[model samples]
Target: MIPHQWYIVLESREIKPGQIVGVTRFGERLVFWRTTEGELVCLRDKCIHRGASLAIGKHHGDEIACPFHGFRYDKTGKVTLIPANGKSSEVASYFHIKRYPVREKLGWVFVWWGESEPTHEPVYFDNVDESFSWSSSRHLWPVHYSRAIENQLDLVHLPFVHTNTIGRGKKTLVNGPVQVVRDGNIAFWVYNEVDHGQKPKKAEDLPPPDFSRQHIHFIFPNMWQNYILDKMRVLVAFVPVDESHTLIYLRVAQKFVRLPLLRKLVDFLALRFSQVVLHQDERVVITQIPIATQLHMEEKLIPGDLPIITYRQMRERLKNV
Candidate 1:
């Protein structure tokens, strides 16, 4: 079942100022654009007149003019002007498109992909802001969006899947209990301790060590954030291209501290580092068979999979609602 809520569709940079891009997600053809004033809007791509794709049309300042018959639409999906029609009444009665609500936050464009009004505003991390430096990349994968999302929520596979890279030398099984917390549409999983070979210890084994922690948060439908530490973070937004394909937007966020040279250097390194880690995850996720299969009755899950179960149940409940 598909969860009904706003999903992160693209990184904000994918649609530049005054540029319009066509995106097909979850069987919907959408036109995403930024106004001259830098506001973002997303609407159904099909024009009411002649069934032309509005994404292939031109943008005149704030309005998008359909290329086929010069039908113009405003950001709200109302046909503001129709060149073929003489009066406004005719255009008003026949020329409207479905417009989805869009909100820009933390360098990403979020779209309400469901039928109902979103119950809450999009969530943002405390460290995400203009002061923080960030860079992003986009990749289209041959897998369902749910599979891509579940890959992020799985902690037990990291030690084996990413062994040569991010998970090198990490413990295979985590010792301490995994902590799970939720608020509305947001869910977070924190693995506090790793088996260090001596004896099973609690999360607070080294009393007040450092500011290092492993934290991953999934905000509703399609956004996931992993905090490697205080200074580095990885944010992933998954957009469903179809039932069997997905587009992934990866953002690496780091503290800049007002130093231009250091910021540039950090941003460059972060982008490369993120790409390496992402490719590792993608290699495994895309190879999974039966893209749209549900996990409720297939496998034997244990306590380590509590987070995954929670996410799956939430998705099922939301879809039923």
Candidate 2:
């Protein structure tokens, strides 16, 4: 997995104040919970003592009580009470579990993917927040997270994979598909035209574009968005469940219609449409020879894969950042 970036691994509603949820993400077992006041907390699922899984433990009023030893821990993962030494005993400073920086935002939960402190907030779409209405769903893909992400970055497969849907134009020839990367983490590209037998132009030969039409942007680590318009777009979180599994959280957000019932209707229909498109991409992605993609994988590439090329390079760089 790429380092030093925030990955959306869960949905906000997945954990309530009095609950503890545990799942495997980024190839690690993690347990997530919230304080009584609703602040999110995350830690390595394993208890330092005897390697017990903290997820099965009970979450008392304000502390997590280990089911094995009744050792109580606060939101900081610091032990406050060790049942064996008596309830009033002072806990040793070394008695603590590994804690990770976490946040709940834009209908998802993010976990920092490094050992150091987080320096920035999780990236969010320009205008996506409480102002927009959205419907979300999660699907499990039996492939590496990188494969799932590249399927979206791919531009050359549209004509053959989604011919009757978004690829109806028979745009087999990918033009410049020019790219712009900013802040070292965000990259966007533009190209949505049908080929007319004209020789495809190189990225350097393309002129400026109006980014407002349809934007495809990716944030390092594991997030991407397709800005279809000012008020509608699709956002996806490629959550790494393990090297061979990924859970994709797909959300279709819109604000063009704000009425109560109407907003829900529009968001629902959009999500349904997006699912169909995602399934089409998934069918072929899972069949690739190698489930995961590497920066220098053995494959012949062409100009049509410029967006994917940028992604692979950036992913390699981010691993060191």
Candidate 3:
């Protein structure tokens, strides 16, 4: 995981008011809840006293009370009421657990995963407004988050992996598959054709792809967008669960159909087809030798792997920064 970036953890609708939701993310146990006013809060699940799971405890208005000892805590993870120490007794300032800074945007919950305080909110895809309706699907992959993200950046695998679906053309020849990077974000334009015993062109040798055309875009941390059309898009979030697991959240957003009923049908069908495409990639990705990938690996890379190579280099630089 990058040291100081915001990572998407869950969708906005997942947490209900007055409900304590416990889940594991970034290899740590976290407890999330909403106050009566619908404000979100996140804290480490473990309690300071007796090491109890605070998520299983009760909710007292805006505070949560540990089940084992009835030690109530506020949103900041500071002890508000210690039953063991009388109600009137003062709780020490040092008695508190870790609190994660959170931000909500575009119907997703993002959490800061570093020691330093965050200076900015999560960056989202621009031009997508409330007019777009979306449908989402989630799948868990038994590989590292980095591996899952790299699969999306791979341009050469479509012809082989998704042969009958999106890759029916058998475009074995990859030309440029041009990549553009800006501020830790990347946009990709693909130019593939059927192999005819001709030499493939280098990325720099090809002419610039049309900027007006739809392309694939990815932002730092863990979010990707397939700008299929002005009114259509496919968004994905590669959420880290552990060293060997990743939760993929896929969504199809479209604004072409405005009727409530028809929009529902369009989103549902789009998401269903999208899931099929995702599963195709999953079957091959899970078999990779290592669950994770590094900037410098033992395996050899080809010219077609420019996007993946760029991703690795960017990731390496971010980890150290």
Q: How many pairs of residues collide in model 3? A: 0
Each candidate structure's TM-score, on Cα atoms with residue i matched to residue i, is 0.87, 0.95, 0.98
Give the alpha carbon lDDT tens digit for every residue of 197-241 in model 2: 688777777766556767688877788888898888899999999
Number of the top-ranking candidate, with lDDT as the measure: 3
In terms of lDDT, which candidate is stronger, 1 or 2?
2
Steric clash pairs (candidate 1): none
Q: What is the C-alpha local distance difference test score of candidate 1?
A: 0.76
Per-residue lDDT of 275 in model 1: 86
Q: Which is the winner by TM-score between candidate 2 and candidate 3?
A: 3
What does candidate 2 score on TM?
0.95
Off by over 4 Å in 3: 204-211
Candidate 3: Cα lDDT at 105: 87
